[model samples]
Target: MNGLFDALERAAGPVTFAPGATLLRGFALEDAAALLAAVDAIAAAAPMRHMVTPGGYTMSVATTSCGELGWTSDAQGYRYAACDPDTGLPWPAMPALFDTLARDAAAQAGFPGFQPDACLINRYAPGARLTLHQDRNERDFGAPIVSVSLGLPATFLFGGIKRTDPTLKLRLAHGDVVVWGGPARLRFHGVLPLAHGTHPVTGAYRINLTFRKAR
Candidate 1:
């Protein structure tokens, strides 16, 4: 894996990477602290946990949610549920700050009036990675996805509709926000295995907040 990213390009954009995808560099730095605090509170209410895929493998990332619905995966399959399977209660409400940031980020990315009903939080430690996959479980594909990165940096892979299509490996660091939708809604994406590192804000892990309109 040492030379995995050698052929890929690092993203330095506050620019559009695709027709409907925008990478806003440092867009969330201003709200970083507040967001982290909110994340802590949300996690306290509904602790993050590793989920099991239908195939029975445990995901490397720890996850939680704060919204009307939370995505869950298990022996049954992946689906959105109103309550946290671990807690047997509704997930914490999405914070106003999170809602506002999602809205503003979406608007800035040319997808105005975006109101996300779900915010999936993912925590990744060193060596943790997400494989290429599409977010197609949402009830509506008309809504865009807004993702915020915090803590240690990682390479984000954005690919075409098919998993075999060429992918772009973009360096997504603290406070970076990526919004994609429209014709790019079903594009495949994932995160490369995280490198070992420490960040002042997140210690040894990275936190990602992904907002989506699930309903």
Candidate 2:
């Protein structure tokens, strides 16, 4: 109990852990609101859509992207592209807040000089979930991943490299940030099915912003 509390306190600012991971809970409620607004603006430009996996399966989560490069998947396999296959247009530019937050969060996590070129925005309604998988589409694994969660809370399943490895379940609420890089960069992770709930701002949905250095 004390150890957990200590970890949380140590994570007060941007916090670094393991080789390729960090967590930042530095943003306030207002910051969260601002980020949500940015997401809305980007979504207005490019609506979220469920993408097809290389295995011919449509992902359960609806996703959109911004920045110089966007992550995508299809029968060809997972990779980053300059344009959205759905619309055949360049992805919306990453919001200034998104870049600022990613850089700040990465620095806090101890990965100084991190500059992400891709930001994947995910929207989840009740029962939506992500299966455990590594984020390997990016060209650089040395850079870490910065993920921010907002709206109704969800359980995050942080697992090891192996698919069968035991996982730690974490309850992540609005404004919570999770960073994983270094040795943990390729670790398996996913979200559990979200329970039905309503948030004052987003109604009955959750939004997650996952920033990466795809270039």
Top candidate (TM-score): 1
Worst 10 residues of 1 by lDDT: 1-10
| Regions of model 1 farther than 4 Å from truth | 1-13
Residue lDDT tens for model 1, 1-215: 22434422354545777779888989999999999999999999999899999999999999999999999999999999999999799999999999999999999999999999999999999999999999988999999999999999999999999999998788888999999999889999999999999999899999999999999
How much does candidate 1 score in TM-score? 0.94
Alpha carbon deviation, residue 49, candidate 1 (Å): 0.2
Global lDDT of model 2 = 0.84
After superposing candidate 2, which stretches have Cα over 4 Å from the reference? Answer: 1-20, 26-28
Q: What are the TM-scores, per candidate, against the unseen true structure? A: 0.94, 0.90
Candidate RMSDs in Å, in order, are 3.0, 2.5
In candidate 2 the C-alpha lDDT for residue 185 amounts to 88
